[model samples]
Target: MSSIKEVSLRRATVADAEAIAAVRVEAWQTTYRDMIPDTYLDQMRVEDSFLHWKQILQALPAAGDRVCVYVAESEGHIIGFASGMLLPEAKFGMQAELTAIYLRPAWQRSGIGRRMVQKVARTLQAQGAESLLVWVISGNAIARNFYEELGGVLLHEQAFSWDGMDLKEVGYGWRDLSVLMASVNAMPTSSSVH
Candidate 1:
């Protein structure tokens, strides 16, 4: 069995776009197998996702932009990634949004996700963000429970349209960055390779 000591997290660079996209596609295929339409999932291509992420990561951050991307790795191989930004629209006073997070199936439930999120939160807080929010597909109970376990509170719900299908999305909010930062800091650092 793989241990957390084998994993490390760091800022993602442009060269990582392809690996990040691959993980995104694979994770979506696995996690959203029944939650999303087969047609939509079938059309998800790594090349397309690579181009999208490359463009996003290549763009220069504007003034006050706190956009960041972090990748989790084990023995130099990318396993998971997360991206976030400080959004203008605030919900429950959360100015930061977790735009995307994905991990290969084999890497899930190993504390990597929590570490990645905490790192993102710390980066956002340093950029002057006070709170953060994440939106998950309503039926994705695994994600919902993960957020809840991290002390997130249900903030709101909205209708999302994808491939002509209407879907419900639930938003989870963390009103205090300090609380999250402290919790992350309290975790045993020895297990983290980085």
Candidate 2:
């Protein structure tokens, strides 16, 4: 495994689609293995998400839309990533939301996730967003704890269906970008927001 010191974060491009898809699939399989049905996770494939990420990276955001995608790389391999946007309507009175964040299981707790999140938060904050929120499947204690450690406040929780199974998800919101920014900044570096 590569050390965090070798990892770097930057905005993603279309060429990264395949690698990003791999990371996404791997992350889902590993992170949600227990929470989600085995059939769903087992059926996931990198090919399935490749075109979607390709389009996402290639398309230009429409007028007044703010979208950001960042990736964490080390040894030329994409290890983790995050995507977020300025919300058209506020949830928990926050103007931005972290739509997705995932890291290879090996990279977890390496501070790469912190740096990736910082990039996303800073990017949205620059786009005139004052606050942000992320949804965590309620049973995902690891993720919920990570968000809480970053000063996230529980804003909402609701029932959601997945593969015809009932599940719960909770929202963790940061009311102020500065607070989120500062909290991550204060932590030891070697990282990303993922």
> Which prediction has the highest TM-score against the true structure?
2
lDDT of 2 at 128: 93
Q: What are the per-residue Cα lDDT tens digits for candidate 1 across 42-105? A: 8899999999989887872542348889999888889999989888788668899998999898
- Candidate 2 lDDT, 12-93, residue by residue in tens: 8889999999999999898887899999999999998999999988873552349989999887889989989988898879
TM-scores of the candidates are: 0.90, 0.92
Model 2 gets an lDDT of 0.87
Model 1 alpha-carbon miss at residue 53, Å: 0.3
Q: Residue 5 of model 1: what lDDT?
A: 61
Of candidate 1, the 10-residue stretch with the lowest lDDT total is 184-193
Cα error, candidate 2, residue 136 (Å): 0.9
User: Candidate 2: deviation at residue 15, Å?
Assistant: 0.8
Instruction: List clash counts for every candidate, in order.
Output: 0, 10
> Once superposed on the true structure, which residue ranges of model 1 sit more than 4 Å away at CA?
1-5, 60-65, 183-191
lDDT measured at residue 90 in model 1 versus the true structure, 0 to 100: 81
lDDT of each: 0.85, 0.87
lDDT of 2 at 25: 96
